[model samples]
Target: MNIIQNPDSTSLKRTIEQGTADQRIAVLDIINEVRKNGDAAIKAYTEKLDRVSLRSFLVTEEEVEQAYKEINEELLTIIQEAACNIRDFHSRQKRESWMTTQENGTILGQKYTPLDAVGLYVPGGLAAYPSSVLMNVIPAQVAGVKRIVIASPPQENGYLPAGVLVAARELGIREIYKMGGAQAIAGLAYGTETIEKVDKITGPGNIYVALAKREVFGHVSIDMIAGPSEIVVLADDTAKAAEVAADLLSQAEHDERASSVLVTTSLSLAREVKKEVYKQLEPLPKSVIARSSIESYGAIYVTDTLDHAIDIVNELAPEHLEIMTEDPMSLLGRIRHAGAIFLGRYSSEPIGDYFAGPNHVLPTNGTARFSSPLNVDDFMKKSSIISYSQQAMLENGRKVAAFARLEGLEAHARAVELRLEDL
Candidate 1:
């Protein structure tokens, strides 16, 4: 990892992947085909891209049962327990519709409605993410979303990963589909004869999937255009080098584009962590990928003070921020921009990824400055409720009309005036 005394903004910025023109064109073609042909286009794309032909996209009960047999009982139990943890955590985020009646007989409030249906795009086959399944689905389910669908690309053997199937089954989600890429996204967004259109699409995917989500933004809701994984550790002299190095590597192994950075006040700690990072990298199975990530995007920034380090972390706005200073909680109020904040050495990044019960789907690539993690709110919609009483309307209707006409919206002013005239 590169060790620098003070890095500038140019050193921190990473280019967000927006896909190439050819990829965008390809995604558009796929989406149009799905719109024109529906199920046939999905089958064609599945056969061409996934190298598997299927008459049906739905995963049957028999396949799900077989998936259970393939997974060991212990793993199933762990998945079940993890699901409970996630459910318990997200249940705290559930909201109910609320209204407030004013003294003037006006009712003003907000109504929260869970989306009718949602499509979860799980990476398929060898790249299956069972944790993602738990993170994305449990929140939507908690939000009272009625129909939750799962879409995954099938392996060459014409089956989704057993772990993914088991995770979905644990959550009682049976509407699993064996499709992937932009085609699956299109099928979920536009609807096919076999697959129903979802109100929102959530989960991670490749460049094509990201591009497909961009194309279908107006047609349906999407989570966000997620970038590569990132981790920023704000530590001090009191922090251990080995633990810091290990936490950095946890995100590096995700992809070559992933970033692992350390901001510390102690120069000695930075030097020690740089050495420990390479030492730990030698035996990692994904060393090649991790090494590429570490060498290209990883760095250790040594600041003059802990406050300076905090400033750098806020500027970076990382996806995952771990505070390893002596007084981690004291600095929480200073941190304004982290998708997730893990305190203390024991609260590692992976704990939130799997068992710690927070949604792992977070904004990446500095988006934490303005975005947030995937939660129950992402699967729900909000409606503004306004019931104006005759007295209230008589009081404020002329003000409303003048305000509307001030904006040159004559119809808006007349609508309120007509209502007032009727009263």
Candidate 2:
């Protein structure tokens, strides 16, 4: 990992840019082809990219039941526990319709409505993630979305992973499709003979999938276009060097482009953590990827004070922030930008990623500055409700008509005038 005394503002800005125009064009072509060819395009692309030919895409109830028998009882128990935790947390974020009535007999309110159907894209094959299944599906269930469909790439054997199937079945989601990449996104957005068009799509995928989501956004609602995973550790002398090093490597192992950075006031601790990272990396199974990530994007920035470290964190707006200090909670209010905040030495990044109730699908590539983590609200929509009594319209109609005429919208003025003509 690179060690810098203090990085300038320009260098910080350059690290967060995610995708290129060429990538966008490539994904756009894939979306267009899928739109034109429909189910045939999806099958062709699945064969070319995933190296599999599929006669059918949907996972049957028999397959789901068989998956439960394939996996161990221990893992099944763990997945159930995680799902319960996720459901409990998101249930708190559920909203209710509300109304207010005035003495003039006018009623105003807001109605919360869940989307009719939602498409969830889960990475398949060797990169299967049951945690993602729980995180994505539970929130939609809490929001009362009835139709939840899943799209995942098929393995070499033309089947989804047992763990992935088990997770979806546990959530009572049986509509699993054997497709992935940009084509899966297209099928979800535009619909094919086998797949139904969904109102909203949510999940994380590679660069192609991200670009496809960007292309089909207006046609169908989507969650944020996520970038590579990133983590920023803010520490002081009180933090343990070994624990911090392990946490940094946890995110670094995600991908070759994933970022793991440490900003601290203690220079000696920074040096020690750097050494610990090297020691921990030697035995990791994904050492090559983690090493590349650490060498290219990882850094240790030594600041003058903890306040300076916090300032750097806010500027970076990392997806995950860990504060390891004498009093971790004391610095909570000082943090203004971060998708998920982990405090103290014990609160590592993976705790929130897997077991904790909070959603792991967070904003990436500095998007935490303005956006937020995926929640129950992502699957829901809101509509304004207004009811006007005859007396109320008679009392205010002419004023509305005069204001509309001032804006040169004569039709709007006439609409109000018609309501008040009898008065």
Candidate 3:
């Protein structure tokens, strides 16, 4: 990992600006081809990229049952428990339609409604992420989405991972498809012969999937155009270098494009953690990926003060921020942006990704600036409802008519005036 000081280095800034106009437009170009050619184009891309020939894109119910049966009892139990926790937590976020009635016979309220159906594009890159399956589907289930669909690439043996099937089943999501990448997203957006079009699509994928979501936005709602995984640790003199190194490596092992950074005021600890990262990297199963990610995007920035460390964190707006410092809670109110915050040395990024009750489907790159982690609200809609009685219209009709006339909307003014005449 490269070590540097604050504010001047361009590593984080360049990451935000990495994707260019040509790369972006090329993604859109691929999406347009997929939309025009539909399943045929998707099959071609699957063969071109994944080097896999598909017998069928859709998986049968019997296949899901087989996968469930094949999954180990222990892993199944874990998925069930995680799903329960996720469901229990997100259930708290469920909101209902409500109205307020006034003495003047006027009623106003915002009604919450669940999207009828949603598609989940599960990425088959690096590894099959069962935790992501839980994060994406559980909230939609909690929001009462009637039908939930999932699309993932098949293994070389023409099989979906047993863990993924088990996770889907645990969340009451029955529809499963053996499709992935931008093609899967395209299939979800524009309904294929076998796949039903969805109101929204949620889940993480490669750059292709991200671009496909961006292209299909007007056709169907999407979670966000997520970037590579990243985590930033803000530790102090009180923190442990080894623990910090392990946490950083957890995110680094995700992909070659992933980033793991440590911001601290302790120069000695920064050096210690940098050494620990190399020691830990040697033993990691995905050592090559982790090494590449760290070498390319990792950093250790030493600040003169803790407050200065925080300023850098806010500027980065990392997907995951860990405060492995003394009195971690004291700085909670100071952070303005982060997809998820893990406090203290014991807390790590993967905790939120797997067993933690919080959603792990967070906004990547610097999107923590505005976008939020996937939540129950992603699967719901809010409607504004207003009803006015004759008396209520008569009481305030002139203000309404005058306001419309001020905008030169004479027809809108007349519509309100004609109703007031009944008074």
The lDDT of each candidate is 0.92, 0.91, 0.85
Q: Per-candidate RMSD vs. true structure?
A: 1.5, 1.4, 1.9
Q: Given candidate 1, what's the lDDT at residue 236?
A: 92
What TM-score goes with each of the models?
0.96, 0.97, 0.95
Q: Which residue segments of model 1 deviate by more than 4 Å?
A: 13-15, 419-423
User: Candidate 1, residues 316-391: lDDT per residue as tens digits?
Assistant: 9999999999989999999999999999989999999999898999998788999999999998889999998999
Question: What would you estimate as the lDDT of candidate 3?
Answer: 0.85
In terms of lDDT, which candidate is stronger, 1 or 2? 1
* Top candidate by lDDT: 1
Residue 25 accuracy (lDDT) in model 1? 98
Q: Which ten residues in a row have the lowest lDDT in candidate 2?
A: 9-18
lDDT of 3 by residue, 1-423 (tens): 777866554545325424667767866766777778877877777776677787676777888889878988898888888877888888898888999999988999999999999999888733778887999988988898899999998776667887887788777777888878777888888886777799999988877777778878999999988788889999999998899999999988988889899999999999999999999999899999999999998999988988888988998898999998889999999999899999987787777888878898888778898989899999999999999987888888999999999999999999999988777
Ranking by TM-score: 2, 1, 3
